[model samples]
Each structure stands twice: as structure tokens, then as C-alpha cells.
Target: MVKLIGDLIKDVIEPGFCLGCNACVAACPMQCIKKEENEIPVLKTGCINCGICYGQCPQVVDPKTLQKAIFGDNPTDELLGTYTQALAVEAKDAIMKAHGQDGGAVTALLSSLLDDGYIDGAVVVGTGEAPWQPVARVATTTGELIECAGSKYTRTPLFIGLRDAVNLYYRKRVAIVGTPCNIVASWRMQFSEPTNRHLGETIRLRVGLFCGGVFRYKEFLKDIIERQLRAPLAEVAKFDMKDGRFVIYLRHKPKRELALSAVKRYIDLPCKICSDFTAEFADISVGSAGSPHGRSTVLIRTPTGAEAFDVAKKFRKFSAVELEKVKPGIEGVRLEAKAKKGAAAKELEIMRRQKKPLPVWLQERPPEPPKETIESLKSISRV
Candidate 1:
């Protein structure tokens, strides 16, 4: 029998494997799944049990299957995944360079795509009503995109923003900016059984950010930043993870730094099991891992990513240094990726030894029925 939302909740969410990407909420045809702020999706009444929600979940879907669907080959690179080229990029836009988290390459690239009419809008994470809280929204212009720049250490359900961009805003073509989990969720929506192919068709570009992990907002911002450090969240200018420390910049005040070890316990539970460090399935993967202080490491993984990057470069939106020229180069990114994968593997082994429930992706199971077979069965059942 096929698994449903209840199974998803018991196996993934209860086991603390849900990535909170909101793909299931977006792909639900009956609108039964509701995505709560910083919470796993809740299934309301009227679920048809079509299995789309279970299939679209990033935690449940196998990464290797999605990789083959998106990249057309089994990736041999263990650390960084398959990619065409790597570069260190610094945004040429002064505002983006100054305000963006690192090099602002993602902001610059999105701006270029919007200005050139390559994409109708982009799904991005912006500041919410509460200070430093991440909220996902659609950016249709460069100004809006710029406002959405910078990193939020907290997780948001970005795929909901993609749904609104296409379904509500009527954007025909959209770009999605997210972390590795979000990218996996996108691919799951695109290729999973009982697919929401129409929704996936609007996603023209996938730009993934490098992530170490995300923290719970209340824990990290409230307990650590506000209470412990005595720094007001409203006065905060930016957040950065650098040199093994979590750095906080405040307005008109001296910045404060906390060793990553100090806040390690605040990291969200779902992040511990994640292995993808560089968003291997994205069109283009970007992060600060392999670049200098004011630059981002860009990995063009597919032709779509290469084309977009080339167009942005031809317009001089950013300056780039080939991977070979950058100090430490891909080695820096490789080391981090390797470490993350190693840690996740160790954790999974421990969980297995404990007989803990694992996500479907990590479980040994027979292949799911194809979409055609599922449709035929549905037809027969209705008869």
C-alpha cells in the first residue's frame, strides 16, 4: 500500500526528518495541507490520499533518482556533485555588494534575469514582521529582489512562495532561490510520482545557497541574540557565519560574535540528517564556502545554469575569478561538504542501530508504481 500524509508525519516529521520546505503544501491539489510558520505541514480535511504530498516531500524522495532526472547521469563527484564550472564571483552592483551576505552573486544574478526578462519573478526569503525572521515571498523587480537579499539563519517554507508566484501572481516563468533542502523539494515536485508538473513548469531557474545548518528562530534569535547577548533584534543589521563563529552586526553599535559551538544546540533537528552541502540538483549552486570574504563560490551544474551565469557576466553584473585562481578554491567547499556528509552518515548509522524510523529516501524499499499505473488503478477503483 502507498503511504499517505499520516505515514509521512509518523515516519518523517515525528522522526525529525522533515525539512520544512513546504513542497507538500504547495503540491496538494485539494489544498488540504497547510504550512504553518516554522512548522511541519498539517493535513486538513478533504485529503484524497492521492500520494502527491508524500511523494513531493524532500525527505521521502531519493536524491539519486532526482539527480538522474535533473542531471541525466549518475553523479560521480561525492562532495560537490556534478557541475560544469566553478567560479568566485563578486557582485558589481554597489548596493548588492554592500548589503548582500557574501558577494551578493545570487542577488545580482536574479536582478539581471529580471531586468532582461528572463524570469517573471523570483521566490526569495525576506525579513518578516518580527526582526530577523525569514518569510518567503515573490520578487518581481530588482528593488524587491535587493530588499530580499542577505541570509537568514532560520528556515522558511520557500516553495509556498513559488506557488503564490505562479498561481496568485500569474507569473509564467519564475526563479527559485533556496538551500539544498529546498532545491531537493523543487526537484521532487518536478519529478515525483503523481507530479504537479504544471507548477514545476513555471520554475525556470533554480539557484541554491550553501548552508551549514539552520537554527530555530526563538532559540537562536531570542535566547541567544536577545537575552544572552543583550542585543535587540530590531537593531540588528545582518547575520553571518564566518570563521567558525556566528557574527551579528548591529546598527551603530559594535558587532558581536559567538562561537558556533555556543549555539550548536539551537540548530533545527531536521538539519542534522541532511547530507547535501552544495545543492547538487540545482541549476546553479552558490555559497561562501570556497570564496574570499567578499565573494561567493558559484558552481554551474547544468546548461541552464551556465547560460544564466554567462548572460549575467556578459552584462557585467558581477566580476568572476575562475576556481583555479581562488585561494583554497574548490578544496574549501569539498572539505565542508565531506564533513557534512560524514556527520550525517554517522548520525544515520546511530539512528539505524537504535531502530529509529528513517525517511523513505534512506530506507530500502521497492520502487513506487509509475504514474501511468497509478492512474489506471484509480480509474479501475472508480468504476
Candidate 2:
């Protein structure tokens, strides 16, 4: 029997392995799946059992299979994943730089793409009705992209914006910025059978953010920030993870910080099992780990990504420091990735010993492809 959302819930969601990337909700033809704040998706009335939701779910899909399909037989890096080059970059736009989490490279890159007419819209996270809460939306202009700047340490279903971009707005070419899990779900939607490939095809670029983990909104914002720290959410200027602490910048008060260990309990459960810290499947990955306080570390992972970066650079959207010029350089990024992967591996091992359910990708290895097939797959361009 073909698996359905119920099967997906039993295998992934119940196991606390669901990434909550919203691929299933976006790809559902009947629009039966709905995602609520800090919850796994719930199915409504439709019961076609088309299996599209199951196929597009990042946890249900085998990541290795998707990697082989996307990156082909390229020699894999133990830490940082497949990439062409690394750089330290900072956005030139003063407003964007000021409002952004670090260097504002992501905001600048998306603006550059929009200015160049490369993409009709971009799926990005913006502040929602509640303070510090993230809501996904489609940005069609540079101003809109800038408004959506900064990092939300909480997870949002980005694919919902993707669906609105393609289906509601009828945007032909689009870009998406998301975490590693979100990138994985994008690949699953692109290559998985019984999925809406058109939704994947509309995505011209995938800009991934380096993620340590995400926090539950209620616990992190309400319990930790409001009650514990005695800071009102509305007064918060920004949220950041710096030097092993969760830092909160408030508009009218001195910034407050708590050691990450203090808030570890609030981290989403699924993040513990995730190993991709640099978004290995993304076109490009950007983060603050390897660069100076005001700069971002960027990894150009694909030819398409390289092309987009080049366009942005040519337009003077951001200033770049060559990997060698940056102190610690890619090594810094590699160390962070290694630490995250190590922690995940240990968690997986612990879960295994406890006889808990695990995602198929973590439990089973897919057979290697033939040499000829690998070569052919590599020749197929994602662009």
C-alpha cells in the first residue's frame, strides 16, 4: 500500500524526526495539511492517498538518495559538504547591514537577484503579528526583501511562502532562504517521485543559513525571554546566538544573554538528529561562524550559486574577503560543522541504543550507483 500522511506521522513525526519544513503542506494537491505554531502538520479532510506529502517530507525521504541525485558523484567533504569556494562577505547597504543579523549578505544577495530580474520573487521569513515570531512570505522587491532581513532563531514553514509564490502570485522564477532541513526538503520536492516538481522548478536559488538549532517559540520567547529575563517581546530589537550564548537585544534596555546550555531544553527535538550544519544540498550557504563580527561566511556550493554570487558582486552589492584573507577562514566553518555533526551522531547512537524510531536516512544506507550512472547524473545541470 502507498504510504500517506498518516504513515508519515507514524514514522517521522511520532519519532520526533519531522523537520517541519512545510514541503508536505506546500506539495499537497488537495491542500489538506495545515501547520500550526510549534506543531507538526495536521491533515484535514482530503484523503486521496496520492502519497505526495509523504514523498516530499524531508524526514521520510532518504537524504543520501537526494544528495546523489542533486550533487551526483562529486567527492563528498566530511565537513562543509560540496562547495566551490568560501568567502567572508558584508553587505554594502547601510540599512540592510544595520538591520541584518550579521553581514546582511543574504538580504543583499536576494535584493541583487531581484534587481537583476533573475527571480520574480523570493521566499523569506519576516516578523509576524507577534513580536519575535517569524512568518514566511514572498518578496518581490528589494524593499520587501530588506524588510524581511535578520534571522529568526525559530523555525517557520518556509515552503508555505513558496507555495504562495508559485500558486497564488503565479511567480515563474523564485528563490528561497532557509535552514539545512528546509534545503533538504526542497531537494526532496524537486526529485522525489509523486511530488509537485513544478514547485521545485520555480525555485531558482536556494540560500541556506548555518543553523545550530531552533527553539520552540513559546518556550524561548515567552518563558525564557519574557518571564525569565523580564524583557517584553515587543521591546526586543534582535535575537542572536553569540559566543555560546543566546543573546537578546532590546530596544530600550541593555541586551540580555543566557548561555545556550541554559536554554537547551527549548531547542526543537528534531534539530538534535540533524547533521547538515552548512546545508550541504543548498546552492549557497551563508553564516556568521567563520567571519568577523560584522561579516558572514559564504559557501558557493554549485555553478548556479557561483553565477548568482558573481552577479551580486559585479553589482557591488557586497564587499567580499577572500577565504585566505579571513582569519581562521573555512577552518572556522569546518570546526562548527564538525561539532554539530559529532553531537548529532552521538544523539543518533543514543537513540539507537534506546530502541527509538529513527529516520531511514540515519538508519539505512542506499546502494551506490554505477560509475556510468554517476557520471551521467553529474552532467545534468540543476540550472
Candidate 3:
């Protein structure tokens, strides 16, 4: 009998229909799947059937349910404010100061988890030369967490690490720091075969960050090109999310102000479809949205998250930023969200289609792309 990979992850049979896209076949880690004509993926031997393809498939047999399942329930009236709240967590290690984008709140949280023996390792999205590099970084020390700091704007698809994370647990525990989609991967990973024993036992924490939308890494690079003079990607310094704008820094300082037309073309697909800017699924959603430099805007969800923040508060790792500076941006986000509800998605569609790709950076690893000053990071870093 022909078996479907979806059966392993869920009770429902996986969709047999195909968009004839080779995404799943190309993405399969086990090399167990093959693509036929019209992008129909055929299962093969050694098919551990990890079900990675099920998530990557563009054609959803079930759109409404699928979209809701991934996005979670829509906004309620009470769910105002950013998805994250401003708070601190005890990350005693000094690594928090160096790694990450700015104030290093995420580094601190991961360190606390590692030091407290709460988790053996964590799954996070580390920036790579290209995109979609969502692998797990086993953090045995605080320094490791710092090394993999910052909010990687590209779609890291971090959920892919669940299987590996379970392997590393060795019956211990692990934490996950990711975006909403990454968290969605976690939720899906729960049932996706070989049932993760560690998931129930040791996958202890989930650290999330306030997100505007999910975008494609390719689009981001393309945007860089539109801004630069079609330079090759030399280095990526920053993906600044301040003032309601996403500022991309490239290595070639000469061609700074890229054409706005190019940027529109390179924006990702999901962010265009999605309206949720804040992640409600995360344990603690953190950001620099409203917080001043050297600070982070944190939102605590679970009790553990609140407790973690409480403990971290004692260290005085960050100062507070005035809410006013961030207010305009947040307001802009709300307006954007509102626009997403009806006609705006269409407007974006037109804008996207008409937009042209900009230029690429000249070199790789450009000078640590400019980061907001420590004082600025501190402003958003704490409660």
C-alpha cells in the first residue's frame, strides 16, 4: 500500500495534489522524496518521512483551516499593545553584553535557561550567508547564546530543528527561541512522527519576539539589491525595525539610499499575506519596537516567562525607554494591521507585482552592520 508522510504527522492523509513546485523535493533532508512532472512529489526509500514537505507545500488543500491553524485565532478586542511586554530575565553570564542585536535580552534569557539547568540546549535562527538556516544551536554556556543573538529577520523556519533538538535532549531538556511561524512549527512538531519524548518532558521554554510579518530571505536580499547598486551581497549589517521602517544596511556605503521601488519587489510573501505583527504564541515575546536604545520591549506570556523576567529584573541589565518614541511606530503598525483587513492586501499585491528588485551589496560580512547604540538598545531592553 502506498503510504503518505502526512499520516505520520497527523491522522489526515497528506494532500496528493501538487503545485508541481520542487520546493519540497529540494528541501527534503533525507532525500527520500522525488518530484515528478507538475511538481508532484513521490515518496521514496529511506523516507524517514519527516513531513517537512507538508509544511513547505504552497498549495494548501485546506486554506481557511490551515491558515488559522498556522496563524492561530485572530485578534480579540482586549489584545491591544505589542505582543511582547517590557521585562527582564536573569541571564547572569557576561555574554549577553556582546551577542545579539543590541541590549541582548534574548541572550540573557537563553543564558538563564542554560545556567539554571532548565534546558540542555535551544533551537534558534542564526543568520547565515543565505537564508532559511533555522537550525538549533546547542547552548551549553551563556557565551553560546550570545554568539547566536539578535532577531534574524529572514524566515529561518526554525521548527526544522525539533527532531535534532529531541536527539540532543538525551532525556534532559531544551528551549526554543523563534518567530511565530517558528512556534507554529513547534506546535506541528508535537505530532509529526516518532513523537518527541523530550518535547513533553524537557523542551521547557519558548522565547518569542514581536514580529511585524514573516518575509522571505530571498526577498530581503533582493531588497538590498534594489537599495544598493545591484551590488553583490558582501555583508549584512542590520535589519533595523525602528520608526515602522525596515532599514537594511549593506557593505557598499557608497550606494546607500536604494530605490524604494526595488525594496517593494523584494518584500517576502507571507508578510504580505499576514497581518499579525506581534506573536502571541511565544512564552516571552521581546523586541526593540517601543523600548529605547540599550533596552528591549518584552512581553511575558506564560507564568514561567513572568518568573524569568522577575528574576532577571534584579540584575538591572537594562534601563527603560520612554513609550512615546515607540508609540508612533506601534500606531503605524496598528494602521498597517487595519489596512491588512480589507483593501490593503490588494494594494500590496499590486505594489509588489509592479516593484522591481534593487541592487545587492558588494561584499559579505560588512562591518557588523550598524546597530542602534547601547543606550538606544537599553531603552527597549527592560520593563
Candidate 4:
């Protein structure tokens, strides 16, 4: 339906609705698009109006249609999307647990999928050329998974590697792990009208990471880490956001902390309007929220996700318990998801009051944002 570049810009881009998922950049048949600031894509030339970008954009695709296409029903929940089960899990292997952000469930699960023939490869985010930056990669081996293990609190145009996974590597079945927007785009690419049926066929599993908002890594790294701390990038061993502060760990030096309120200024614009926190459409969604420091909360959304978990268990890849056993537990996740929904609803209201027409995705509110959500744009402006 979106036949022209102008339509996409007006409907999604201009409204600050583009999620920077790179679906448009990747789907461009002419390769006329490239990412700017390693975030949103910019057209390299004049309009092509090929419609491929629109066909793949999650912003304009209706979730009801996507739900019916994926699950054959419109069953919905006010929070946490459509899911069958929720649990807390951690990798069984010591090595996996050591390298991953939390329990290393993603790395462990994807490794099992790769070994057990469930998927030939996985689209993952790894360290970019610069410190604290994220780069999309396709990992087919355990070593590759380890390389991408830790969290990068930033957005990576992960699906951009989908083409290489299919056309170049010829992987018939592949898994993909991404934020909510990335998962949405993957599903829409499969079922949307005039879809890339081939790519959809190759997507064996969709894994979503729980996200609140992703900060601009370049700004956080350059402005805060380099300018404020004057720390050498190589000496910085890890960066994390926990307990309302951005924690920077160095190889031997003392750690540094920055309040989340201050860091909120660098959050991507599209993240403010997001409507899915737990990646409701993903086969399995995993996040550290509502779990122990060394564990991940896993939301099994579909039969496929359950099947993958079973296979991972069979391989002795992870150990999981009922979510009820955890301290924060399912209630913690629910409250966080609800808070994000509320914030997004407020954002939409402000947009409407300002006479700004919203795109289809943002016009509706009330679902999805990861943990530690920003409360008010007004508060952020003061920052």
C-alpha cells in the first residue's frame, strides 16, 4: 500500500515513528539506503518507491493481522503480549553463564538450536569496532555466540544481516534475537501483504530482548565515557545499567556510575513511543528484569518458543524454575510493562494535543516498553 518514499517518510519517518530497526535499509532492493549515526537509515539517492521498505516496516503493520497470521487467532493480553508460559532461566554451562549478560539464556538457547538443527544460524548483536557500540552479526557457532554474549544497551539494525544469512551463507533456517521493534519487523516481513515470503520462510525462530529504551551508544560512549570520565576505551571492560545508574567497569580502575535520569537524554526518539516491552510476538522473549542478578526471565509466547526451550533443556543448556520462585517475579515484569504502556499512552496524548497526526503504530498506545522506563518528556527536557 505504501508505494512511495514520500508516504513512508510522512507516515512513519516524519512522525518520529521509525524504530531504527533497519528493515527498510535492508529491504531496499537497490541498496540505496545506509544507516546514519548507526541508527536510522537515510536514503542515499532520490525516491525509488519500491515499497519494499514499507512492506517490511513494523511501524505501519497492524498487530491484529500479524497475530492472526502467526498464531491463527487474535488472543491478546493487556500486557506481555500473547504468551503461553513464563519462567526464570539460566545457562547450565559455566562458560555460557560467565560471558552472557545474565543467565546467558540467549547464547545457550541459540547454541542448542544451532547444534540440534533447529536453526542453522542466528542473527545477533556483537561489539562494534568502537567500544560500547553494537554491530549486527550472524553467529553459527558457539564461539560466535560467546563473542556476542554480553548486553549492549543500544540498538543494532540486526535484521540487516538477514540477507547475508540467507543469500550468502545459504542458511535455510535461522534464529534472530532483537528488541521488540526488531521482532515486530521480522513477523511483519513474514505475513504482511506482498511480504518477502522467502525470508519469512527462513526465519525459524524470533527471540526478543526485553527493552525499556536504548540510549544512543555513540553519545553515551563519547560524551559521557570519554569526555566526562576521560577513560581509555580499551580499559573499559563492561558497561551496564542497574539500580537506576549506568555502571562502567574498567579492567583495573574503579567503576563509574551515571544516573538513569541523566542518561535519558540520549535515548533514541523512536524508543519513547514504543508499544511492546516483552516482545509479545516473539517465539521466546528473554530479559534480566524480574529475575536474579545471574538469571533471565523467559517468556514463552508460542508453541515454537516452548519447543525451543524443550530442546535447550534436552541439551542441558539451561536450568529454569517457575517465575513465582523469583523475588521480583512475574508481578515485577507485569508492573514494569504496565508502566511503559502508561508512559507511551501519555506520549501519544501529548502528540494528539499538539495536533500531530500519528502513524498507525503509534496512533494506538498502551503496550510495550522494557524496564526502567522514562517517566516524562518534560523531566527529560530538563536533563
Q: Which has the higher lDDT value, candidate number 2 or candidate number 4?
A: 2
RMSD of 2: 2.3
In model 3, the Cα lDDT at residue 320 comes to 40
lDDT measured at residue 141 in model 4 versus the true structure, 0 to 100:
98
List, residue by residue over 1-383, the lDDT tens digit for candidate 1: 66788888887777778767788898889999997756578888999888888877878766666654556567858788999899999998899998789999999999889888888899999988999888889999889988999998887888889889988999988999999989888766665666676777688889998888898788778887899889999999999986578999999899998898778778776677778889898889999988988999999998788877877776688899897798779999999899889878887788889998777667776475465643442232121
Ranking by TM-score: 2, 1, 4, 3
At residue 14, candidate 2 shows an lDDT of 77
Query: lDDT values of the candidates?
Result: 0.83, 0.83, 0.48, 0.77
lDDT (10s digit) by residue, model 2, range 67-114:
666665553687988888889999998998997889999998889888
After the best TM-score superposition of candidate 4, give how far the Cα of residue 225 lies from its true spot, in angstroms.
3.0
Evaluate residue 103 in candidate 1 and report its C-alpha lDDT on the 0 to 100 scale: 96
Off by over 4 Å in 4: 45-48, 62-65, 72-76, 360-383
Q: On a 0 to 100 scale, what is the lDDT of residue 289 in model 4?
A: 78
Q: After superposition, how far is residue 150 of candidate 3 from its true place, in Å?
A: 1.9
Best by TM-score: 2
How do these models rank on lDDT, best leading?
A: 2, 1, 4, 3
Candidate 4 lDDT score relative to the true structure: 0.77
